[model samples]
Target chain A: MEEDENIKKLNPVEMKLLTHIIKNEWKTLIRGKWVIGYGLIFLILTDTLLRFGGGGAEVLLSLSNVMLLFIPLVGMIYGILYIYQSREFVELLLTQPINRKTLFWGLFCGISTPLMAAFVVGAMLPLGWHGILAQDPGASVMVLALGGMLTLIFVALGFVLGLAFYEDRIKGFGFTIVIWLFMAILYDGLILMAIFTFGDYPLERFVIAATMLNPIDLARIMVLLEFDISALMGYTGAVFRQFFGTNSGILTASGMLVLWLAVPAWIGLRVFKKKDF
Target chain B: MNNYKPIQLHLFGGLILLLLAWTSVSEASASDTAADIVVSPDGPVVSIQEAVNMARPGDHIRVEAGVYVESNIMIDKKLTLEGIGYPEIDGNLEGHILIIAADSVTVSGFFLKNSGRSHVRDYAGIYIDKAKDVVIENNRLDNIFFGIYLSATERGVIRGNEIRSYERRESSSGNGIHLWNVKDPKILDNKVEGQRDGIYLEFAKGAEISGNRSNNNNRYGLHFMFSDDSVYRGNTFNKNGAGVAVMYSKNVDMIDNIFENNWGTSSYGLLLKDINDSRITGNRFYRNTVGIDSEGSNRVIVHRNDFELNGWAVNIKSSSRENQFTENNFIENSFDVRTDSPRNPNHFEGNYWSHYEGYDLNRDGIGDVPYRPVRLFSIIIQRQPESLILLRSMFITLLDTAERIMPVLTPATLIDEKPKMERIR
Candidate 1:
């Protein structure tokens, strides 16, 4: 109840200005060709994968692997770059009688929604055209959903970075790439290192906890659930299966992903609200 | 003295008289034809025991279509027990259904079931002891402790038997086809399921096991120890509890076999332990926990085998040495090779590994750069098994890449120097 009062709802004027800003942002971003270009990249990736990858299951695996590595980087870079590129427009809006919440959410939605659509549609077209959806509709839908979640989560992350370092472009770009590298590479490396270093301990619970810490690993494990053949996973895979528990596992992962999305966008909005343009 | 003696005396006297006449008649018609002893449900001699008691050495005892509830049906003469219409032989859970104690015996075309389970004795559907030139074929065995137990048998052929059991525990069940101290026992075209071991060989030499489907057993599909010069080919062992294990065996030729889907904490498609001079060729190990776990195994040649989607294609323990893996296609396995030791003495050459990303220059079929199958992360997994949860992690990929460029932690000698550009058929 206290939290409900803490959330400030927009007045009618703020809502009108918010919708206007969202419409204009969408127009500029769509007309800029970056969104369509980002989409075409996924089209080419999925098309090549479907053409050369051997079986139906194999193509889906390849697509997920590529998606896991590429989606976050693309999403974050797009979000940060868009925020920094429209600096003049954002500052000019700051001069008007506008609420910060209106501008922040409008920009966030405008940047994230199209990129999510681009990734999903780009990947889905090749698979549907090749009739891979008929072979394994469940796994295909899962890959697209995971891809969409990653895009939204990373875009929110990118917004926080953009708003935090708008004045300093070099630091902003540097920190953005560093964050991507940490999530994509260093986080997993540290997990492996910890596993090897503490080899003598009972590490099952530790490993699962570690996997939950990283969004990428969490996403990958979710994909692993879809292709959870008992043989390929061996004994270790069995432990993962027991813990994941199919439906509950997906629920927990999706919940975590939602949390990941909400926290970052909330922080980015907070930064936008107080930052002096 | 006994014009009205006990029925035992009457039966004994009648059997002696019949055997004397039958032996004399069989000697006269010896080479041309063996005599026929028909045991029908409504005949003068209805029981198979009564017919065998009245027959000569080389007679054919034809059992007509009926259920026989007798146990310990002993065949002590060199004769044939042929079932006319797959007559049921129920042991009533008492003892062995058929005990062939004589040489040159043939038992075929029967449905044998419900042998007695004892902690002391191995009650089987058909028990052959010290027999030579015996053939037990075309029989269906169900709910048996042991399906076909052959001990000290020479030149026996056990073929086309469908053996199924329902015992879930290994201690209560016996092997489907047990060969102990046997020579040249050709096990052919049998389907054995849900037993301790599908085909077990202990001290069985020069045995030929082929064309069998053994799946979902309590323990191993094929478990052999100290069996030398045996050939296992054209067999499918799937989803067994521990898969196949060949221990302390030499000159083992395993060709064209499919070992699939056996996943457990310490299971493998084939576990070669303390064996020497074996050839694993043209065998497909698919989706097993470990395709071939070699420990103390030496001088084995693994050629042209397809290891597909297994957890580990080949896991070589520190004690295994001098094994050659060549021309094999390692496709999409979670880990191509894992070794406990960093100093690998076994050779991996000319194999096509899906993980090999080296380029083939000079238009040759082989890659210019040698491909190392063991990654640093696999070594980490060897030490820490729980780290396998981090499989396909990007961090592990980077570590593997850096470790591949500079030989560190992983065995440098474990390189496939002449890696094939394409998969070997």
Candidate 2:
């Protein structure tokens, strides 16, 4: 009777917030046929590529390339557009008996969960059918986890940008695209130039630090290390092996990825708290 | 006619008398004092030195099964030193166990061990100096500075000997079979391991090394310097610091040898430096860092060899030219060919590459399109080694595909015009 009383004494506002987020996220995902269509396309492309290319590790590598290029773009664009399209809906929800934190989190989860679900279902179905998980569980799991982390990070970043420029949809979408472009393409080019420009000094530690700054390079290095091509890695690879070879390195990288997730979401929530509807 | 007959008869009589005198003199010398001296613990002669001192030229001294702590036992006459039951000759870490300085010497069936260690001199288990027609066979040498040292010796046969040492560093250990300024030495069926080099030949000519298994040495399995007209066949060299190195030699034939498991940062199956007019054929190089690292070598024919799972099947330096690589099977290597320079002067034809993607349009057992083994990424790696971490990346793959479609960065001349459609068995 005491346990039952303690359960009944829970905050009703939290319960209502959970239910509202689940209901809204589900409705949005069902209404958007393009999301389901893109998911099916991803599944077919991964399956076909795996079937034709060499199996297991090669498939994981190919999928990583696609994820690094397409996932952030899809997540960011969908995030900003969802926020703009649901502006009236969010305004209507704000008139209800809920706090700003609950409303912000509900909307953020409502937008991000469906995109994450689409990616997971699209990628995991093909990967499971091809027995990639059985062949190389470590690399497969790492690739999937990295993909998930990238989706969350970019979606949260999209929210931060969307909430900051709430009045101008063009500016919000434009900033999201630019950030994705910078992260995916231009960042690696700049890193390569830096490494080449300062080729004389020992740049092992510097390269590792630079890779951590970009999540895509971090995921790429993690996958490459799993391939055990250290013989071709030369000196910098040796340094990476010495450092990232331990469990501590993996822990640090994972923690940093989590931090990448948390910081943007916190900033987006702060922006939501002060926004004038 | 009569005068010629008398002169011929006199010449014949003189020849017969000379032959009779020679026979009598040889018989007298053979019967005079060249006795079989037996040295045993219970025999009249208990020491080998005493037996050797008491013997004359063409005599046989047999040492029985006992530990003879003797060093610098010089054989200055045409003598036969035979061990009756594999006697142990210990040098006690002093000097060479046995030294043969005369011609027609035979030292066989002994267990020789523990020669002195000196940086100044190469003490050996069996040292042959300025000798000809010397046969040093059926002996086991252990824990010696040099196992069998042949200096200024010719026509020496070193066969069926096992030489080993326990030295870890190359600076302190000597070679198992060291030949210096020797000619026509036949090294056959010797098993050498755990030495500086399994076999070292310098300034030697017309040597034939066959059927030897050299493994786990500190330095090279077999090293040759300025040794010309030498042929080494049917040898197995495995897991050495660096496999067989042939430097500054010409007209050498390396055939049917198995060079395997020599994997390190700077190791190779066979390293050729400044070698010309050599034929390396029918050999198998498996799992080496580099199968054949050729530098400044010319006119070499590398044919019908199998290179499997090596880091680089053939790493040819730019200084090497005019070499022919034909009918070789390159299977499952990380990189088929890595050259330092973009300009290729050598010929690579009719080799079966496992990564070849071209089809045989005319059914002639050769691909219609030529195959380029060197990738543009490999060129990038040559410039910036750290860029290898980006291997198999999308951007690099795109760059490679673009370069392949339009031959831009990779050298156009480094193509195998006749790649084999089927693997060469």
Candidate 3:
């Protein structure tokens, strides 16, 4: 009964420090020059492409190219680097009377929130300025939402990898690069080979399932569904339209994305709780 | 203006004299007194069928403006069936409104509607069978199975008619102006919409189809099968299921027509299948899925035409050969040329492609370097259609650039050696 009282008394102080940690992280990221530089890069890229891309849909497609290729890479690398750099700070915090769960949650929120803010501010400024968001609200919202989700998912993945191998920084960095490469490039190649090998089978269900397995493919199919150019897509596109054309399909895809974000973060939190400083 | 009035008066008097002499000659040729039989609601002959039955050869049946519920009004003699102020002929959704079984017949200025829809028989607003020198003109046909049908007829003229139907499916609809085994039919100044095919010709020879507007049909705007030695000029075909299909025909002259906005998976602005010796000149094909799709066609001269903003400017299949694509302007198409086979035998020369990047060093009108039109990406798309989603992606751009530099996988023979340096104006 005395131990329970002591633990209850320590919870309020840790909760107070959690907010402080979050605020400090936000200020640090905002004050950094790289945040503004990232925003400027996105603004220029979107504006220049919009000026020359001939159409709104074309511009969005080009932006999607950048988003799919670079967002995960940037998110994953940033997550690992930030966690690794803040190892001393985390160690210093552990020496205090704060609970491990509170520190881990505080750190996770700190790192991911700034990265997400950077991405959102960077992407939304140009899309809003060019009236792309207004012209096609559904597609623009989808693109932004998918980009944000990818940032969160990949960041969580980076965190999990970082916490799992906290002692070896190089190993953590190497794994992050390999994961990004596998998800972005090699996954699509494997899908193509599988489709060609199973060409004769009725592979619509299998194809849809496989797309859900890769977050990038899911995002691409979602955007393609919005474009409504099914004529170009001969048959598989017809299947995608048939499935994703409904409200249920959209709901399910979003639910899957949320679950994707939650699973890795949950696993990372568990690992952080048990890991030695 | 005041001095020309006397000359104008003199010209009017001469024209009146000519008209009187022409009427006398026509009267003498008939060799019988042509009586004007008026059919009104209160007249002795209250129905058009009775008037047509009472009329003899070389007679005139003037139908007064009233709702005449008639079906199967067969004319078996040479008669002039004229409608005064566009009389309404309601078939009561039963059968054909009028059937012309005789030669030298004229049925004009009537509003025909609601011919019966039948699968066993082909119902029409005006059906002419085995008739020569028939004139079915200035008629308004609505909600019909077939608007105007001419079968085994010679020297028929279907002019100045408006044909429309509210058919949603191709199986339930019929052609607007359907001709079978006809010779020398002059189809002019007609507007057709919402039918299966706006104008269909089968086994028709020496037809002159001009000044017609056909749009929004369930199938081809203008379809031809075995209709040889025909001419279609100054017509507009727009937004049909497939714009126009000319198959199994030879020596067809298609000039100065406009085909626009025929967009679908397998649609084309113009489809030439098994056609030979055709001349498609001075036409505009704009915004179609495929501007022109040719299969099993040979010796086709596609000259001085404009193909703009289509998915594929020209999709020529392997079976097409000896076709000359010369002096045409291909502007802003997704792919300027797409072919199934790797080898192209058709000649593509002196054409201006908007995407061509070659330079002219000698200040001549032609580019020094040849332009290869068939891209390796298009071949990949043909093999794997789902790769179309990767269109304009960086990976696709990289692959296309690599293929362009290496000249591998794309058709080597499908090059324009004499690409025009400037846009063909």
* Candidate 1 chain B lDDT trough over 10 residues, lowest sum: B26-35
Retained true contacts (fraction), each candidate? 0.49, 0.05, 0.03
Scoring each candidate complex against the real one, what DockQ results? 0.32, 0.08, 0.14
Residue-wise lDDT of candidate 1 within B109-223, one digit each (tens)? 9999999999999999999999999999899999999999998999989999999999999899999999999999999999999999999999999999999999999999999
Give the Cα lDDT of each candidate.
0.86, 0.82, 0.83
Interface RMSD of each: 2.6, 4.3, 4.5
Deviation of model 1 at A251, angstroms: 6.8
Q: Compared with the true structure, what per-residue lDDT tens digits does model 1 show for residues A1-277?
A: 5345338687898788878877887788789887889889888988887775545666777788888998999888888898888889889988987767788888888779889999999999999999998887998999999999999999999899988888888898889899889988888878777877887777777888787877888898787666534332465545565775457667777778888898998899878887888
Range of the 10 consecutive residues with the lowest summed lDDT in candidate 1 chain A: A228-237
lDDT (Cα, tens digit) per residue for candidate 3, span B182-254? 9999999999999999999999999999999999999999999999999999999999987899999999999
Error of 1 at A250 (Å): 6.6
lDDT of 2 by residue, A168-273 (tens): 9889988988887777767766766776798788776787787778766666666555543323422335675566556655676777788888899988877787
lDDT of 2 by residue, B1-425 (tens): 67699889999999999999999976774573443677787877887778877888888887789888899988888889888788998899998889999999998889999999999999998999999999988999999999999999998899999999999998999999999999999999999999999999999999999999999999999999999999999999998987889999999999999998886667789999999999999999876768899999999999999987676789899899999999998875656788987699999999988667678879999999898888777787677766655554556666676777688777789989999976687
TM-score of each prediction? 0.80, 0.64, 0.68
Candidate topping TM-score: 1
Q: Any residue pairs clashing in model 2, and if so which?
A: none
Error of 3 at A91 (Å): 10
In model 1, the Cα lDDT at residue A74 comes to: 88
TM-score of 2: 0.64
Best by DockQ: 1
